[model samples]
Target: MVAITDKEFKQLTEYIKVNYGIHLKEEKLMLLTGRLQKVLQQEGFNNFTDYYHHILNDQTGQAVVTLVDKITTNHTFFMREADHFYFFRDRVLPFLANTVQDKDLRIWCAASSTGEEPYTLAMVIDEFFGKDKVFWDTKLLATDISSQVLDIAKKGIYSNEKIAPLPKHWKTNYFKKHDNENSVLIDKIRNEVIYRKFNLMDTTLPFKKKFYTIFCRNVMIYFDYKTKIELVNRLYHHMEYGGYLFIGHSESLTKEFTKFKYIMPAIYRKE
Candidate 1:
Protein backbone atom coordinates (compact mmCIF):
# COMPACT_ATOMS: atom_id res chain seq x y z
CA MET A 1 0.00 0.00 0.00
CA VAL A 2 1.18 3.51 -0.76
CA ALA A 3 1.67 5.36 2.52
CA ILE A 4 0.08 8.79 2.77
CA THR A 5 2.58 11.56 3.43
CA ASP A 6 2.09 14.28 6.07
CA LYS A 7 1.23 16.95 3.48
CA GLU A 8 -1.08 14.54 1.65
CA PHE A 9 -2.87 13.74 4.91
CA LYS A 10 -3.36 17.43 5.68
CA GLN A 11 -4.73 18.14 2.22
CA LEU A 12 -7.15 15.21 2.23
CA THR A 13 -8.36 15.91 5.77
CA GLU A 14 -8.88 19.61 5.04
CA TYR A 15 -10.78 18.82 1.86
CA ILE A 16 -13.04 16.35 3.67
CA LYS A 17 -13.69 18.81 6.52
CA VAL A 18 -14.46 21.72 4.22
CA ASN A 19 -16.72 19.85 1.83
CA TYR A 20 -18.39 17.34 4.20
CA GLY A 21 -18.10 18.87 7.72
CA ILE A 22 -16.24 15.73 8.80
CA HIS A 23 -13.29 16.24 11.14
CA LEU A 24 -10.49 13.80 10.48
CA LYS A 25 -8.01 14.11 13.32
CA GLU A 26 -4.30 13.24 13.31
CA GLU A 27 -4.95 9.87 14.90
CA LYS A 28 -7.23 8.98 12.01
CA LEU A 29 -4.34 9.05 9.52
CA MET A 30 -4.03 5.28 9.60
CA LEU A 31 -7.74 4.89 9.13
CA LEU A 32 -7.69 7.27 6.19
CA THR A 33 -4.81 5.47 4.57
CA GLY A 34 -6.46 2.13 5.08
CA ARG A 35 -9.69 3.28 3.51
CA LEU A 36 -8.21 5.32 0.67
CA GLN A 37 -5.23 3.24 -0.39
CA LYS A 38 -7.35 0.89 -2.45
CA VAL A 39 -9.10 3.83 -4.04
CA LEU A 40 -5.75 5.29 -5.05
CA GLN A 41 -4.62 1.98 -6.48
CA GLN A 42 -7.84 1.39 -8.42
CA GLU A 43 -7.60 4.82 -9.98
CA GLY A 44 -3.99 4.07 -11.03
CA PHE A 45 -2.50 6.67 -8.74
CA ASN A 46 0.83 5.86 -7.10
CA ASN A 47 0.48 8.13 -4.05
CA PHE A 48 -2.06 10.15 -2.08
CA THR A 49 -0.80 13.47 -3.53
CA ASP A 50 -1.43 12.28 -7.09
CA TYR A 51 -4.83 10.99 -6.06
CA TYR A 52 -5.65 14.36 -4.44
CA HIS A 53 -4.67 16.24 -7.60
CA HIS A 54 -6.77 13.86 -9.70
CA ILE A 55 -9.75 14.44 -7.45
CA LEU A 56 -9.26 18.21 -7.67
CA ASN A 57 -8.97 18.11 -11.44
CA ASP A 58 -11.86 15.72 -12.11
CA GLN A 59 -14.65 17.71 -13.76
CA THR A 60 -17.60 15.43 -13.13
CA GLY A 61 -17.26 15.45 -9.30
CA GLN A 62 -17.54 11.67 -9.34
CA ALA A 63 -14.04 11.34 -7.95
CA VAL A 64 -14.94 13.26 -4.81
CA VAL A 65 -18.14 11.30 -4.43
CA THR A 66 -16.19 8.07 -4.68
CA LEU A 67 -13.67 9.42 -2.17
CA VAL A 68 -16.34 10.36 0.34
CA ASP A 69 -18.09 7.04 -0.07
CA LYS A 70 -14.90 5.12 0.57
CA ILE A 71 -13.61 7.25 3.43
CA THR A 72 -16.81 7.63 5.46
CA THR A 73 -18.34 4.84 7.46
CA ASN A 74 -21.86 3.75 6.50
CA HIS A 75 -22.32 1.14 9.19
CA THR A 76 -25.97 1.11 10.29
CA PHE A 77 -28.62 -1.55 10.86
CA PHE A 78 -32.36 -1.72 11.48
CA MET A 79 -33.30 -0.55 14.96
CA ARG A 80 -29.63 0.09 15.72
CA GLU A 81 -30.64 2.54 18.41
CA ALA A 82 -34.06 1.18 19.38
CA ASP A 83 -35.07 3.78 21.97
CA HIS A 84 -35.47 6.62 19.49
CA PHE A 85 -38.02 4.57 17.54
CA TYR A 86 -39.99 4.00 20.76
CA PHE A 87 -40.03 7.72 21.53
CA PHE A 88 -41.05 8.54 17.96
CA ARG A 89 -43.91 6.05 18.02
CA ASP A 90 -45.14 6.42 21.58
CA ARG A 91 -44.70 10.15 22.14
CA VAL A 92 -43.77 12.19 19.08
CA LEU A 93 -46.27 10.63 16.67
CA PRO A 94 -49.14 11.17 19.11
CA PHE A 95 -48.22 14.82 19.54
CA LEU A 96 -47.95 15.31 15.78
CA ALA A 97 -51.20 13.47 15.21
CA ASN A 98 -52.95 16.12 17.26
CA THR A 99 -50.95 19.22 16.34
CA VAL A 100 -50.17 19.13 12.62
CA GLN A 101 -53.24 20.88 11.25
CA ASP A 102 -52.69 20.15 7.55
CA LYS A 103 -52.55 16.37 8.09
CA ASP A 104 -49.25 16.63 6.22
CA LEU A 105 -46.44 15.15 8.25
CA ARG A 106 -42.94 16.07 7.06
CA ILE A 107 -40.26 13.85 8.52
CA TRP A 108 -36.60 14.00 7.46
CA CYS A 109 -34.15 11.22 8.06
CA ALA A 110 -31.04 13.30 7.41
CA ALA A 111 -28.43 10.55 7.27
CA SER A 112 -30.33 7.52 6.07
CA SER A 113 -27.65 5.05 5.02
CA THR A 114 -28.82 1.99 3.04
CA GLY A 115 -32.50 2.49 4.06
CA GLU A 116 -32.58 0.71 7.41
CA GLU A 117 -33.34 3.71 9.62
CA PRO A 118 -35.92 5.32 7.36
CA TYR A 119 -37.55 1.99 6.48
CA THR A 120 -37.90 1.25 10.18
CA LEU A 121 -39.38 4.72 10.60
CA ALA A 122 -41.88 4.08 7.80
CA MET A 123 -43.01 0.89 9.52
CA VAL A 124 -43.55 2.76 12.76
CA ILE A 125 -45.56 5.46 11.00
CA ASP A 126 -47.59 2.83 9.14
CA GLU A 127 -48.43 1.08 12.38
CA PHE A 128 -49.24 4.38 14.08
CA PHE A 129 -51.61 5.63 11.39
CA GLY A 130 -52.97 2.19 10.34
CA LYS A 131 -55.86 2.57 7.91
CA ASP A 132 -55.93 6.33 8.35
CA LYS A 133 -52.55 6.70 6.58
CA VAL A 134 -54.20 7.55 3.26
CA PHE A 135 -55.59 10.78 4.74
CA TRP A 136 -52.20 12.01 5.87
CA ASP A 137 -49.11 12.75 3.78
CA THR A 138 -46.76 10.75 5.97
CA LYS A 139 -44.07 10.07 3.38
CA LEU A 140 -40.55 10.46 4.75
CA LEU A 141 -37.68 12.30 3.04
CA ALA A 142 -34.55 10.27 3.62
CA THR A 143 -31.23 11.82 2.53
CA ASP A 144 -27.60 10.86 2.63
CA ILE A 145 -24.32 12.22 1.22
CA SER A 146 -23.23 9.08 -0.57
CA SER A 147 -24.90 8.24 -3.86
CA GLN A 148 -23.70 4.65 -3.47
CA VAL A 149 -25.72 4.19 -0.31
CA LEU A 150 -28.66 6.11 -1.75
CA ASP A 151 -28.78 3.68 -4.68
CA ILE A 152 -28.81 0.75 -2.26
CA ALA A 153 -31.57 2.42 -0.25
CA LYS A 154 -33.65 3.03 -3.35
CA LYS A 155 -33.58 -0.71 -4.11
CA GLY A 156 -35.21 -1.42 -0.69
CA ILE A 157 -33.77 -4.93 -0.52
CA TYR A 158 -31.83 -6.45 2.37
CA SER A 159 -30.82 -9.81 3.74
CA ASN A 160 -33.21 -11.26 6.30
CA GLU A 161 -30.45 -11.19 8.91
CA LYS A 162 -30.03 -7.46 8.36
CA ILE A 163 -33.70 -6.91 9.21
CA ALA A 164 -33.96 -9.47 12.00
CA PRO A 165 -34.16 -6.78 14.65
CA LEU A 166 -37.48 -5.48 13.28
CA PRO A 167 -40.68 -6.51 14.99
CA LYS A 168 -42.32 -9.71 13.76
CA HIS A 169 -45.46 -7.89 12.68
CA TRP A 170 -43.46 -5.32 10.76
CA LYS A 171 -41.43 -8.05 9.11
CA THR A 172 -44.60 -9.84 8.06
CA ASN A 173 -46.63 -6.85 7.00
CA TYR A 174 -44.13 -4.50 5.28
CA PHE A 175 -41.75 -6.95 3.62
CA LYS A 176 -41.82 -9.88 1.24
CA LYS A 177 -39.33 -12.68 1.58
CA HIS A 178 -37.34 -13.59 -1.53
CA ASP A 179 -36.60 -17.23 -2.42
CA ASN A 180 -33.05 -16.54 -1.24
CA GLU A 181 -34.44 -15.40 2.16
CA ASN A 182 -33.53 -11.76 1.53
CA SER A 183 -36.41 -9.42 2.30
CA VAL A 184 -37.60 -6.75 -0.08
CA LEU A 185 -39.58 -3.87 1.34
CA ILE A 186 -43.13 -3.98 -0.01
CA ASP A 187 -43.84 -1.28 -2.58
CA LYS A 188 -46.30 0.58 -0.34
CA ILE A 189 -43.70 0.99 2.38
CA ARG A 190 -40.81 1.55 -0.05
CA ASN A 191 -42.63 4.27 -1.96
CA GLU A 192 -43.36 6.11 1.28
CA VAL A 193 -39.69 7.08 1.60
CA ILE A 194 -38.15 9.56 -0.85
CA TYR A 195 -34.40 9.07 -0.96
CA ARG A 196 -32.07 11.86 -2.10
CA LYS A 197 -28.38 12.65 -2.07
CA PHE A 198 -27.80 15.59 0.27
CA ASN A 199 -24.61 17.16 1.48
CA LEU A 200 -25.05 18.40 5.05
CA MET A 201 -22.26 20.98 4.58
CA ASP A 202 -24.42 23.08 2.24
CA THR A 203 -24.63 26.59 3.70
CA THR A 204 -28.41 26.72 3.36
CA LEU A 205 -31.14 24.11 3.35
CA PRO A 206 -33.27 23.96 0.17
CA PHE A 207 -36.58 22.84 1.69
CA LYS A 208 -39.58 25.14 1.32
CA LYS A 209 -41.49 23.45 4.14
CA LYS A 210 -40.31 22.87 7.67
CA PHE A 211 -40.08 19.34 8.98
CA TYR A 212 -42.01 18.07 12.01
CA THR A 213 -39.17 15.74 12.93
CA ILE A 214 -35.57 15.19 11.81
CA PHE A 215 -33.55 12.04 12.45
CA CYS A 216 -29.84 12.97 12.02
CA ARG A 217 -28.52 10.19 14.29
CA ASN A 218 -24.88 9.00 14.45
CA VAL A 219 -23.46 10.89 11.44
CA MET A 220 -22.66 14.01 13.47
CA ILE A 221 -20.03 12.14 15.44
CA TYR A 222 -17.63 12.75 12.54
CA PHE A 223 -18.10 16.52 12.70
CA ASP A 224 -16.21 18.95 14.88
CA TYR A 225 -17.78 21.27 17.48
CA LYS A 226 -18.25 24.23 15.15
CA THR A 227 -19.62 22.17 12.29
CA LYS A 228 -22.05 20.34 14.56
CA ILE A 229 -23.25 23.58 16.17
CA GLU A 230 -23.73 25.29 12.81
CA LEU A 231 -25.47 22.24 11.36
CA VAL A 232 -27.80 22.05 14.37
CA ASN A 233 -28.70 25.71 13.98
CA ARG A 234 -29.37 25.15 10.27
CA LEU A 235 -31.61 22.21 11.12
CA TYR A 236 -33.41 24.40 13.68
CA HIS A 237 -34.32 26.88 10.95
CA HIS A 238 -35.68 24.06 8.82
CA MET A 239 -37.93 22.56 11.51
CA GLU A 240 -41.40 23.50 12.65
CA TYR A 241 -41.85 25.01 16.07
CA GLY A 242 -42.05 22.31 18.79
CA GLY A 243 -40.68 19.80 16.27
CA TYR A 244 -38.53 16.99 17.50
CA LEU A 245 -34.84 16.32 16.71
CA PHE A 246 -33.58 12.79 17.33
CA ILE A 247 -29.80 12.52 17.34
CA GLY A 248 -27.52 9.65 18.21
CA HIS A 249 -27.45 8.81 21.91
CA SER A 250 -23.70 9.42 22.06
CA GLU A 251 -24.12 12.94 20.62
CA SER A 252 -25.12 15.97 22.69
CA LEU A 253 -25.53 19.71 22.42
CA THR A 254 -24.67 22.21 25.12
CA LYS A 255 -27.31 24.77 26.21
CA GLU A 256 -25.15 27.60 24.86
CA PHE A 257 -24.90 26.24 21.32
CA THR A 258 -28.45 25.44 20.25
CA LYS A 259 -31.98 26.75 20.78
CA PHE A 260 -33.46 23.22 20.98
CA LYS A 261 -34.84 22.19 24.35
CA TYR A 262 -33.64 18.86 25.67
CA ILE A 263 -36.46 16.32 25.89
CA MET A 264 -34.27 13.33 26.75
CA PRO A 265 -30.87 11.89 26.01
CA ALA A 266 -30.37 12.34 22.23
CA ILE A 267 -33.82 13.92 21.84
CA TYR A 268 -34.57 17.66 21.55
CA ARG A 269 -37.57 19.82 20.76
CA LYS A 270 -37.73 23.11 18.92
CA GLU A 271 -39.13 25.83 21.16
Candidate 2:
Protein backbone atom coordinates (compact mmCIF):
# COMPACT_ATOMS: atom_id res chain seq x y z
CA MET A 1 0.00 0.00 0.00
CA VAL A 2 1.22 3.48 -0.84
CA ALA A 3 1.33 5.81 2.15
CA ILE A 4 0.50 9.53 2.02
CA THR A 5 2.71 11.72 4.20
CA ASP A 6 1.42 14.77 6.08
CA LYS A 7 2.89 17.27 3.64
CA GLU A 8 1.72 15.28 0.61
CA PHE A 9 -1.77 14.96 2.04
CA LYS A 10 -2.00 18.67 2.79
CA GLN A 11 -0.72 19.57 -0.65
CA LEU A 12 -3.14 17.29 -2.47
CA THR A 13 -6.14 18.28 -0.34
CA GLU A 14 -5.47 21.99 -0.78
CA TYR A 15 -5.18 21.61 -4.54
CA ILE A 16 -8.55 19.85 -4.74
CA LYS A 17 -10.21 22.33 -2.40
CA VAL A 18 -8.96 25.33 -4.36
CA ASN A 19 -9.63 23.95 -7.83
CA TYR A 20 -12.87 21.99 -7.23
CA GLY A 21 -14.25 23.23 -3.89
CA ILE A 22 -14.11 19.73 -2.38
CA HIS A 23 -12.92 20.13 1.17
CA LEU A 24 -10.83 17.31 2.62
CA LYS A 25 -9.80 17.59 6.23
CA GLU A 26 -6.77 16.08 7.94
CA GLU A 27 -8.80 13.17 9.32
CA LYS A 28 -9.56 12.03 5.78
CA LEU A 29 -5.97 10.91 5.21
CA MET A 30 -6.85 7.25 5.51
CA LEU A 31 -9.88 7.67 3.26
CA LEU A 32 -7.82 9.43 0.61
CA THR A 33 -5.06 6.83 0.84
CA GLY A 34 -7.54 4.00 0.51
CA ARG A 35 -9.34 5.56 -2.48
CA LEU A 36 -6.15 6.22 -4.39
CA GLN A 37 -4.33 2.99 -3.59
CA LYS A 38 -5.31 1.24 -6.80
CA VAL A 39 -4.45 4.26 -8.92
CA LEU A 40 -1.05 4.65 -7.24
CA GLN A 41 -0.20 0.98 -7.71
CA GLN A 42 -1.32 0.97 -11.32
CA GLU A 43 0.62 4.12 -12.16
CA GLY A 44 3.81 2.86 -10.45
CA PHE A 45 3.87 5.64 -7.88
CA ASN A 46 5.27 4.41 -4.57
CA ASN A 47 4.31 7.54 -2.64
CA PHE A 48 1.56 10.17 -2.65
CA THR A 49 4.03 12.95 -3.46
CA ASP A 50 5.03 11.24 -6.72
CA TYR A 51 1.40 10.71 -7.61
CA TYR A 52 0.67 14.36 -6.87
CA HIS A 53 3.51 15.44 -9.10
CA HIS A 54 2.20 13.30 -11.93
CA ILE A 55 -1.24 14.90 -11.61
CA LEU A 56 0.23 18.43 -11.72
CA ASN A 57 2.45 17.61 -14.68
CA ASP A 58 -0.10 15.89 -16.86
CA GLN A 59 -1.20 18.29 -19.62
CA THR A 60 -3.96 16.20 -21.21
CA GLY A 61 -6.15 16.94 -18.11
CA GLN A 62 -7.27 13.30 -17.75
CA ALA A 63 -5.13 12.80 -14.67
CA VAL A 64 -7.20 15.35 -12.78
CA VAL A 65 -10.40 13.77 -14.11
CA THR A 66 -9.41 10.37 -12.76
CA LEU A 67 -8.36 11.90 -9.46
CA VAL A 68 -11.68 13.72 -9.04
CA ASP A 69 -13.69 10.63 -10.00
CA LYS A 70 -11.87 8.43 -7.51
CA ILE A 71 -12.01 10.94 -4.66
CA THR A 72 -15.56 12.33 -4.96
CA THR A 73 -18.60 10.33 -3.90
CA ASN A 74 -21.50 10.02 -6.34
CA HIS A 75 -24.06 8.11 -4.33
CA THR A 76 -27.48 9.11 -5.71
CA PHE A 77 -30.59 7.18 -6.68
CA PHE A 78 -33.93 7.81 -8.35
CA MET A 79 -36.31 9.87 -6.22
CA ARG A 80 -33.49 10.47 -3.75
CA GLU A 81 -35.38 13.47 -2.37
CA ALA A 82 -39.04 13.06 -3.25
CA ASP A 83 -40.39 16.28 -1.73
CA HIS A 84 -38.30 18.52 -3.99
CA PHE A 85 -39.64 16.72 -7.04
CA TYR A 86 -43.20 17.03 -5.82
CA PHE A 87 -42.76 20.76 -5.15
CA PHE A 88 -41.13 21.16 -8.56
CA ARG A 89 -44.08 19.53 -10.26
CA ASP A 90 -46.79 21.15 -8.12
CA ARG A 91 -45.55 24.73 -7.78
CA VAL A 92 -42.38 25.60 -9.68
CA LEU A 93 -43.41 24.20 -13.03
CA PRO A 94 -46.75 25.92 -13.10
CA PHE A 95 -45.15 29.26 -12.22
CA LEU A 96 -42.47 28.91 -14.88
CA ALA A 97 -44.88 27.67 -17.52
CA ASN A 98 -47.13 30.66 -16.98
CA THR A 99 -44.59 33.41 -16.45
CA VAL A 100 -41.74 32.72 -18.87
CA GLN A 101 -42.91 34.66 -21.94
CA ASP A 102 -40.29 32.99 -24.16
CA LYS A 103 -41.62 29.53 -23.22
CA ASP A 104 -38.06 28.39 -22.46
CA LEU A 105 -38.18 26.58 -19.16
CA ARG A 106 -34.46 26.54 -18.35
CA ILE A 107 -33.48 24.17 -15.58
CA TRP A 108 -29.95 23.19 -14.56
CA CYS A 109 -28.97 20.19 -12.44
CA ALA A 110 -25.56 21.44 -11.40
CA ALA A 111 -24.31 18.43 -9.47
CA SER A 112 -25.97 15.75 -11.55
CA SER A 113 -24.24 12.61 -10.32
CA THR A 114 -25.11 9.64 -12.52
CA GLY A 115 -28.19 11.53 -13.86
CA GLU A 116 -31.07 10.53 -11.53
CA GLU A 117 -32.05 14.04 -10.35
CA PRO A 118 -32.09 15.69 -13.76
CA TYR A 119 -33.86 12.70 -15.28
CA THR A 120 -36.50 12.93 -12.58
CA LEU A 121 -36.92 16.63 -13.34
CA ALA A 122 -37.33 15.85 -17.03
CA MET A 123 -39.93 13.16 -16.31
CA VAL A 124 -41.90 15.57 -14.13
CA ILE A 125 -41.84 18.22 -16.83
CA ASP A 126 -43.02 15.69 -19.39
CA GLU A 127 -45.94 14.72 -17.15
CA PHE A 128 -46.87 18.33 -16.35
CA PHE A 129 -46.96 19.53 -19.93
CA GLY A 130 -48.30 16.32 -21.47
CA LYS A 131 -49.62 17.08 -24.99
CA ASP A 132 -48.45 20.67 -25.11
CA LYS A 133 -44.82 19.71 -24.43
CA VAL A 134 -43.94 20.27 -28.09
CA PHE A 135 -44.80 23.96 -27.92
CA TRP A 136 -42.39 24.67 -25.04
CA ASP A 137 -38.66 24.06 -24.70
CA THR A 138 -37.71 22.20 -21.50
CA LYS A 139 -34.28 20.82 -22.24
CA LEU A 140 -32.19 20.57 -19.05
CA LEU A 141 -28.46 21.02 -18.55
CA ALA A 142 -26.95 18.45 -16.17
CA THR A 143 -23.33 18.82 -15.10
CA ASP A 144 -20.75 17.31 -12.77
CA ILE A 145 -16.99 17.46 -12.34
CA SER A 146 -16.56 13.72 -12.74
CA SER A 147 -16.47 12.67 -16.38
CA GLN A 148 -16.94 9.03 -15.39
CA VAL A 149 -20.37 9.68 -13.81
CA LEU A 150 -21.27 11.97 -16.69
CA ASP A 151 -20.56 9.09 -19.08
CA ILE A 152 -22.82 6.80 -17.07
CA ALA A 153 -25.48 9.55 -17.04
CA LYS A 154 -25.27 9.98 -20.79
CA LYS A 155 -25.93 6.26 -21.25
CA GLY A 156 -29.10 6.51 -19.09
CA ILE A 157 -28.86 2.88 -17.98
CA TYR A 158 -29.34 1.72 -14.40
CA SER A 159 -29.85 -1.48 -12.50
CA ASN A 160 -33.40 -2.39 -11.52
CA GLU A 161 -32.54 -1.82 -7.87
CA LYS A 162 -31.12 1.62 -8.64
CA ILE A 163 -34.39 2.69 -10.27
CA ALA A 164 -36.76 0.94 -7.85
CA PRO A 165 -37.73 4.13 -6.01
CA LEU A 166 -39.43 5.78 -8.99
CA PRO A 167 -43.19 5.73 -9.47
CA LYS A 168 -44.73 2.74 -11.21
CA HIS A 169 -46.15 4.92 -13.96
CA TRP A 170 -42.76 6.51 -14.47
CA LYS A 171 -41.10 3.10 -14.71
CA THR A 172 -43.71 2.09 -17.23
CA ASN A 173 -43.68 5.18 -19.42
CA TYR A 174 -40.11 6.47 -19.26
CA PHE A 175 -37.91 3.40 -19.25
CA LYS A 176 -37.42 0.28 -21.37
CA LYS A 177 -35.80 -2.97 -20.33
CA HIS A 178 -32.13 -3.07 -21.23
CA ASP A 179 -31.77 -6.64 -20.02
CA ASN A 180 -32.88 -8.81 -17.13
CA GLU A 181 -30.99 -6.78 -14.53
CA ASN A 182 -30.93 -3.25 -15.99
CA SER A 183 -33.24 -0.74 -17.63
CA VAL A 184 -32.55 2.19 -19.90
CA LEU A 185 -34.33 5.55 -19.86
CA ILE A 186 -36.37 6.14 -23.01
CA ASP A 187 -34.75 8.60 -25.41
CA LYS A 188 -37.57 11.08 -24.97
CA ILE A 189 -36.56 11.58 -21.35
CA ARG A 190 -32.88 10.89 -21.94
CA ASN A 191 -32.43 13.47 -24.66
CA GLU A 192 -34.20 16.08 -22.63
CA VAL A 193 -31.17 16.18 -20.28
CA ILE A 194 -27.84 17.27 -21.74
CA TYR A 195 -24.83 16.14 -19.73
CA ARG A 196 -21.60 18.16 -19.42
CA LYS A 197 -18.50 18.22 -17.23
CA PHE A 198 -18.44 21.34 -15.04
CA ASN A 199 -16.43 22.49 -12.07
CA LEU A 200 -18.47 24.61 -9.68
CA MET A 201 -15.30 26.48 -8.68
CA ASP A 202 -15.00 28.08 -12.10
CA THR A 203 -14.97 31.85 -11.65
CA THR A 204 -17.44 32.53 -14.42
CA LEU A 205 -20.44 30.34 -15.16
CA PRO A 206 -20.37 29.35 -18.83
CA PHE A 207 -23.98 30.01 -19.75
CA LYS A 208 -25.21 32.58 -22.23
CA LYS A 209 -28.62 32.77 -20.52
CA LYS A 210 -29.64 32.34 -16.90
CA PHE A 211 -31.70 29.43 -15.56
CA TYR A 212 -35.24 29.41 -14.16
CA THR A 213 -34.48 26.60 -11.73
CA ILE A 214 -31.23 25.02 -10.52
CA PHE A 215 -30.84 21.77 -8.54
CA CYS A 216 -27.42 21.86 -6.90
CA ARG A 217 -28.34 19.33 -4.26
CA ASN A 218 -26.22 17.23 -1.89
CA VAL A 219 -22.81 18.02 -3.31
CA MET A 220 -22.30 21.27 -1.38
CA ILE A 221 -22.01 19.39 1.90
CA TYR A 222 -18.44 18.52 0.95
CA PHE A 223 -17.30 22.14 0.90
CA ASP A 224 -16.32 24.36 3.82
CA TYR A 225 -18.24 27.49 4.90
CA LYS A 226 -16.30 29.92 2.76
CA THR A 227 -16.24 27.67 -0.28
CA LYS A 228 -19.94 26.95 0.08
CA ILE A 229 -20.83 30.65 0.32
CA GLU A 230 -18.69 31.52 -2.69
CA LEU A 231 -20.36 28.79 -4.74
CA VAL A 232 -23.85 29.83 -3.61
CA ASN A 233 -23.07 33.42 -4.60
CA ARG A 234 -21.88 32.25 -8.02
CA LEU A 235 -25.02 30.17 -8.54
CA TYR A 236 -27.13 33.13 -7.43
CA HIS A 237 -25.63 35.28 -10.15
CA HIS A 238 -26.59 32.84 -12.90
CA MET A 239 -30.23 32.28 -11.97
CA GLU A 240 -33.20 34.19 -13.28
CA TYR A 241 -35.01 36.48 -10.85
CA GLY A 242 -37.74 34.56 -8.98
CA GLY A 243 -36.08 31.26 -9.94
CA TYR A 244 -35.93 28.46 -7.40
CA LEU A 245 -32.90 26.58 -6.08
CA PHE A 246 -33.35 23.14 -4.55
CA ILE A 247 -30.61 21.87 -2.29
CA GLY A 248 -30.32 18.75 -0.17
CA HIS A 249 -32.60 18.73 2.85
CA SER A 250 -29.53 18.23 5.01
CA GLU A 251 -27.99 21.44 3.63
CA SER A 252 -28.97 25.03 4.34
CA LEU A 253 -27.79 28.47 3.29
CA THR A 254 -27.84 30.92 6.18
CA LYS A 255 -28.85 34.52 5.41
CA GLU A 256 -25.25 35.71 5.85
CA PHE A 257 -24.12 33.27 3.18
CA THR A 258 -26.65 33.97 0.45
CA LYS A 259 -29.15 36.37 -1.07
CA PHE A 260 -31.65 33.62 -1.96
CA LYS A 261 -34.87 33.82 0.05
CA TYR A 262 -35.68 30.73 2.00
CA ILE A 263 -38.98 29.25 0.90
CA MET A 264 -38.85 25.91 2.71
CA PRO A 265 -36.41 23.65 4.54
CA ALA A 266 -34.36 22.94 1.45
CA ILE A 267 -35.80 25.28 -1.17
CA TYR A 268 -34.72 28.87 -1.86
CA ARG A 269 -35.71 31.43 -4.42
CA LYS A 270 -33.75 34.24 -6.10
CA GLU A 271 -35.83 37.33 -5.69
Q: TM-score for each prediction?
A: 0.98, 0.99
Best by lDDT: 2
For model 2, the stretches where C-alpha displacement exceeds 4 angstroms are none
TM-score of 1: 0.98
Candidate 2 lDDT (Cα, 0 to 1): 0.94
Could you give candidate 1's per-residue lDDT for residues 113-217 as a string of tens digits? 999999999999999999999999999999999999999999999999998888888888888986587989999999999998999999988898999999999
lDDT of 2 by residue, 106-152 (tens): 89999999999999999999999999999999899999999999999
Residue 130's lDDT in candidate 2 = 99
The weakest ten consecutive residues by lDDT in model 2 span 1-10
The residue pairs that clash in candidate 2, if any, are none
